[model samples]
Structures are given as C-alpha cells and as structure tokens.
Target: MITDLANAMSRCRRTLWQDALGAAALMVTLFAGLHLPALF
Candidate 1:
C-alpha cells in the first residue's frame, strides 16, 4: 500500500513538472508574440 502511494506521488510530480514547463513555454511564446510586433 505504501509503495502504491509513493508511485502515485512520483507520477503526479512528474506530470506537474511537465505541466510547469509547458506553461513556461506558453508564456514565453505569448510574450514574444505580443512584444515582437512593436519592435517592427
């Protein structure tokens, strides 16, 4: 039982890390899209 719980927690942490990275990428692209037009 404890092992199952640990496995689940590890999986959740990995997913959270992936989600955070995706969110950071999205924010970077969004900011670039918003600011790049002004540079021209």
Candidate 2:
C-alpha cells in the first residue's frame, strides 16, 4: 500500500544520510592524518 512505500522511502533516505555522514567523517580523518604530521 501507500504507507509501505512511504516507509520504504524514509528508510532509504535515512540510510543515505548516514552514509554521507560517515563519508564526511572519513574524509576529515584522512585529511587530518595527512596534514597533522607536517604541523608537529
């Protein structure tokens, strides 16, 4: 039904959002790892 479709869409959106956040965190960590040693 319509409700099931809505629920599925919301679940997919949540998963994508989490993935984006995880990717951002990973990028930040990688950038810092590459740059921090030069500052020390």
Candidate 3:
C-alpha cells in the first residue's frame, strides 16, 4: 500500500513538472512572437 502511494505521488510530480515546462515554453513563444516586431 505504501508503495502504491509513493508511485502515485511520483506520477503526479512528473505531470506537474511537465505542465510547468509546457507553460514556460508557451509563454516564451508568445513573448518572442510579440517582441520580434518591436525589434524592427
């Protein structure tokens, strides 16, 4: 039972980490897309 809980916690942490990375990438993409025009 303890092992199952640990496994579930690890999965949740992995998912949260992936979501954070995805969100960061999306923000960077949007920021670059908007800022590129300003550089000209």
Tens-place lDDT per residue, model 2, 1-40, is 9999999888798588888999999999999999999999
Which candidate do you rate higher for lDDT, 2 or 3? Answer: 2
Cα lDDT tens digits for candidate 3, 4-32: 99998887985888889999999999999
* Residue 23 lDDT in candidate 3: 100
Error of 3 at 30 (Å): 0.5
Show model 1 residue runs off by greater than 4 Å: 1-11
lDDT of 3: 0.92
Q: Model 2 misses residue 13 by how many Å? A: 2.2
Model 2: pairs clashing at backbone N, Cα or C within 3 Å: none
Q: Which sections of candidate 2 miss by over 4 Å?
A: 1-11
For residues 1-40, could you state the per-residue lDDT of candidate 1 as single tens digits?
Answer: 9999999888798588888999999999999999999999
The backbone clash count of each candidate, in order, is: 0, 0, 0
